[model samples]
Target: MNVAINRKLILNILLFVVMIGVIIFVIRDSLSEIFTELGKTSWPVLLGVTMFGVISQVIEGYTIKNIANEFNREFSIRDGFFASAYATFYRVVTFGTGSIVSEVIYYHKKKLRYSEGTGTSALRMITYKIALMIWALFFLVVKNDAIQRYITNGTFLVIAGIFVTLLIVSVLLILSLNINAQVLLIIFCNRWFKHQKLRDIVDRINNQVYSLRAAIKAFIHDRNAVIRVFCSNMAKLVVWYFLPFFILVQEHPTIDIWLTVALISFTVILGGVLPAPGGIGGFEFVYVLLFRNVVGKVDAVSSLLLYRYATYLLPFLIGMIYVLFNKQRQINHEFKKAKKRS
Candidate 1:
């Protein structure tokens, strides 16, 4: 067991290193230009970007707090923020796979049951998806002409994204609310799969689905919490969508904020369709493709770099600091307890 644990730790470390290397390689060409643009950018604009970025993460923390409070009123905002930061760190390092695991473990450490933790994570994800679709649809309609004028295929992409998102939400709802569907799925899997391991995996998934169902039912009944979660997520999306505009607005004061928001909404929707981790490669591609005509190639590249820094790097760095500090505090507490025992 110890050997297995060690091996897993080593693998995770290697994966983290590899992810960092890939990120650096992807941005290698633009590093110089990004720095040049940074030098030219005003301090006030940079500060504004940083402020909004921090605000977005805090809102995410609050969203987590609100959700967890439904399950356990003892859950505090601090715990929520810790879980949020921890999840963000793992999400980036593990290419999005570790986010759910990270949050579950964090919540469990905070004394929530495993099922509660799982439910919290699952509900948070559902609400986030719903919020994304809502904002995407709203902006898509409000700024339809602007998006069409900028990108010839913008309408099609946004509509396709909305359709796919809706489909995913529908499936989750069916699984959560439809007991017959769940039973049939389990029965089908049990009959089709002969291997014990595959069967065990399916059983575990079924159990998780049950937990999610309970969470969905509870969350749906609490209309106030539902509204707050949606509003918080919408605010986060607004900050994210407008970040690039702020990044470039100093140089291009005439750039339309509404148009930028529309373009970003389209980019996010299309980017989410891709399987890339944290929407890294897919998001950059879509952003550049959509913004190049409006901002020109050089500015688009530079603005994207800054935009990425604000949206991705800042939150990640903050999360990393919080995680490391938490670990150190744990170690110190253990040492104090050991000393007292001695």
Candidate 2:
């Protein structure tokens, strides 16, 4: 266990280094350009971006609260806020994908049993991804012309096909999870693990998946809960996707909002496959690549900076501070409890 933990720590460090390196690489090429653009950004715009940053997280916390309440009665808005903040914070800091694990852990710490926490997190994950892809699909359709021209036929076809296929699979996966997660036995029953030791691990995973689905079925069975979850998650996503559009327009009014939405959303979902948490290096790389096509170097850098601060960096800082403050509060609460016991 200690070895496993150490390995995870090392891997996270490497990913963090990669993020830093990518940021440096971007800055290295256009150091003066990036700085000048940043300098030109006015204070009011930054402040507005900061407020939107808070609004985005608050909506996210509310969504988490909605789902968590079904399974964990003790769940409150305050706890939900911290959970959302911590989830974002850890996802930004931690290296590997499946950043929702942090949110699951947050739920467990607050009141949920492991199974309940993991189940709700998994359910929310499916819902959020479905919404994200839907948003991606909508924007892609609206900006199909620009996108197709931007990347020619063969490349465009392959990516669009992949996105469509993933959406189909995710829908099928959700159906299977709700009806009978054992549906996986059809595939996993085969001797795909290669070795007996690995086979044992696969068996363990099968059992865990079964348990997680059962927990999901318990609370998500309610019709109203399901609708609320979907609507809330979609709203949370809209705030995130379009918050930058507002900022970018303030900088360059003629800029194509749908184009910005299409590319950023694409890059965000595409960057998830990278090992970097929260799409670290790949996200900025693709954003700059896309932005350059639409605006000058100064506008490109400035727009991306505003977007990053409004949605990503500012949220990260706020989340980090919330986590630290919560940790300190937890310590104090524990000390008081111990003192009362004594």
Best by lDDT: 1
Clashing pairs in 1: none
lDDT of 1 at 291: 88
Give the per-residue lDDT digits (tens) of candidate 2, residues 1-342.
555555555555565456556445544553444355547778887777777777877776776777788777778767776776677666666643536777777888888877778776766667777777777777777776665655456236426644764775565456447545455553555545567777776675565565467666775677787787788778877777776577778868887777777767766665544334463476676566566777766666677776766666655566667766665565556555555555
Error of 1 at 231 (Å): 1.4
Positional deviation of 45 in candidate 1, in angstroms? 2.2
Per-model TM values vs. the true structure = 0.83, 0.74
Candidate 1 local lDDT, 34-88, one digit each (tens): 5566677788987888887888878888888888887888888677766877887
Off by over 4 Å in 1: 1-41, 150-152, 193-200, 274-280, 337-342
Name the top TM-score candidate.
1
Q: Which residue pairs come into collision in candidate 2?
A: none
Worst-scoring 10-residue span by lDDT in model 1: 25-34
